[model samples]
Target chain A: MKYYVCLMVVFLFSVQIQAQKVAVFDSYSDLEKAVLSDENTTYVVNFWATWCLPCVKELPYFEQLNSANKNLKVVLISLDFKNQYETKLLPFLKENNIKSEVVLLTDKDYNTWLSVVDKDWSGSIPATLVISKRKKKFVEKMFSDYEELNQYVNSIIN
Target chain B: MKKISVLLLFVAFIVTAAFTSIAPTPYKIGDVATDFKLKSVDGKMYSMSYYKKAKGFIVVFTCNHCPFAKKYEDRINDLAKNYKSQGYILLAINPNDPEVEPDDSYELMQQRAKEKGFVFPYLLDEGQKIYPQYGATKTPHVFLLDKNRVVKYIGAIDDNVDSAAEVKVKYLENAIAALENGKNPSPEMTKAIGCSIKSKK
Candidate 1:
């Protein structure tokens, strides 16, 4: 009937909207490999979480940068509690329409892996690491605007 | 009148120049920290001098809204309760600007302390001058000071943030234990993931 067709359309629309799947990284080395393996692309690895306000606020800038460029790979590493992945993280990703390659960092031993990420990083959220073949820079601060964010990325990529 | 005006301008320039030239440096390990008088949630003023008889102080820069701070609240409470009998004081300071994070206001700090049954003093850095002095970049950052007020250990509470049960290395506990034995704590500085302290620009 007509009513059945309308319900199916709504269901299909919902599925399509939430189609972006998030990759999970349980090991720090796996994530390290992912970052270093793609030599052709400049990796802008950002550590963030659903609970961190600054991280959520500046996400759009990264998404914008990802869409505007082809060589730049914006890897959004979610530090949200592993338990909240299904209930909180997935819903948030879908709601925000994030197009960047998202990954949930599932490492429990932070002390061991934090230094591996960046020696200068004091385990702060909204921190960014811009890595390319030529240079690498780690900043433990929030990017205020898109211009500032792009400047940091372009410096390494270009 | 022109000479007097010139003299006043010179004084003004000198004062501004002095302030700009001397930026406040944060205390590092082995440096003596200056005492600060801050208001607590219980409507009382507190300073490091207040706990004169104590061996050291566990100064935690934490806030209300940060989930990482919330996760460590009970552990902080436990540290205070267990260590209070052993001549140590745990002082929690909220350093995030309230305008940036409304939940971290003085009123909410009092509410959170009461709700969580915090036995220690929950103080507020009202003008936000104290945190930068200690070089605290994130919420739940801790600075352990000896009786001489020298910064002994600085950083996160532990290795595992989410679960306390499965924790292997208790960094804070180890630091306190080292101090109790008259020995310096190994791996004195540590890093843990935390929310950035909101600053009013």
Candidate 2:
């Protein structure tokens, strides 16, 4: 009976995670600590927003990368306006069915923190950072398609 | 044989162009900015030399469409109006390609300048030649240049983009003040967060 109950709890917990709303992050350090906690794990972190059309276009490619590679985790860090979280970001996420671990960063002081992420980064949306135990890559541009993103992510993961 | 090699080179160019999307290394502090005779909203060509008596310029890369640019519009106007009297004139340039962003067309630029009561010349980086020289990465980017065209500062208008009232560090203004006092602006170059200057894909 205990074994059955434990299985039920595990299933329920996963279901909740599967339908998880975006995790809100009030600061950049909190985000970095949470996302980069596991050094052995590879992460494909993308900075994007709903208002940015190019970001929206390339989002599905990241989603495709997520479902295709279970070991490689993809985190979508949203920079949407805090006020429009309910009106725009949440609905857009639900409509598109974005399944990756998504987080919203409301940190206002960008210039000071951007260099910490990547010296070359200009804080533009659709920027990507791929990290693994052996290597890392930061690109301040969008991936044109799934093949482009998939190949780039795989190159880092391997 | 020559034709075959030419065909191979063309194919290689196409593949690389589609696959790679990296920002060019923009101007660093102390780099001398190039002068251009871009067309202004007034339908006349103007260059840095036009402001003969000024000590320096606040060249701002902005547009009508970007939300971030909209937020800084009035603040930018204030900067231009206030700083011009202090010997630093502001030059607003819309560097985005009109084909990629319809709202950034020349006609719309004129309309925006009128609507916002732009005190400075709002110019177009025709054929997108000038912005690349400065290595501007996004709309609402600023480059504070001395009378000799040396870049003194580069980046955002302030610390807070959402509300000008809440801004703590006025990056551009401080840079202007630094220049007036013959001192280097601390934190000379900073990162910009806005719409990447649109170009033909």
Point to the candidate with the largest TM-score: 1
- Per-residue C-alpha lDDT of model 2 across residues B58-168, encoded as one tens digit per residue: 999999988778989999999988988888889999999999889999999999999989888999988998898898878889999999999999999999988888899
lDDT of 2 at B113: 92
Counting clashing residue pairs in each candidate, in order, gives 0, 0
Residue pairs with colliding backbones in model 2 are none
In model 1, where do residues sit more than 4 Å from their true spots? A1-20, B1-23
- Candidate 1 accuracy as TM-score: 0.88
What DockQ would candidate 2 receive versus the native complex? Answer: 0.57
> What TM value does model 2 have?
0.87
Which is the leading candidate under lDDT?
1
Write down the TM-score of model 2's second chain: 0.87
Cα lDDT tens digits, model 1, B1-201, are: 999999999999999998886546767789887778999999999999988799999999999999999999999999999999998899999999999999999999999999999999999998998988898888899999999899999988888888899788999999999998989998799888899989875
The DockQ-derived docking category for candidate 1 is medium
Global lDDT for candidate 2? 0.87
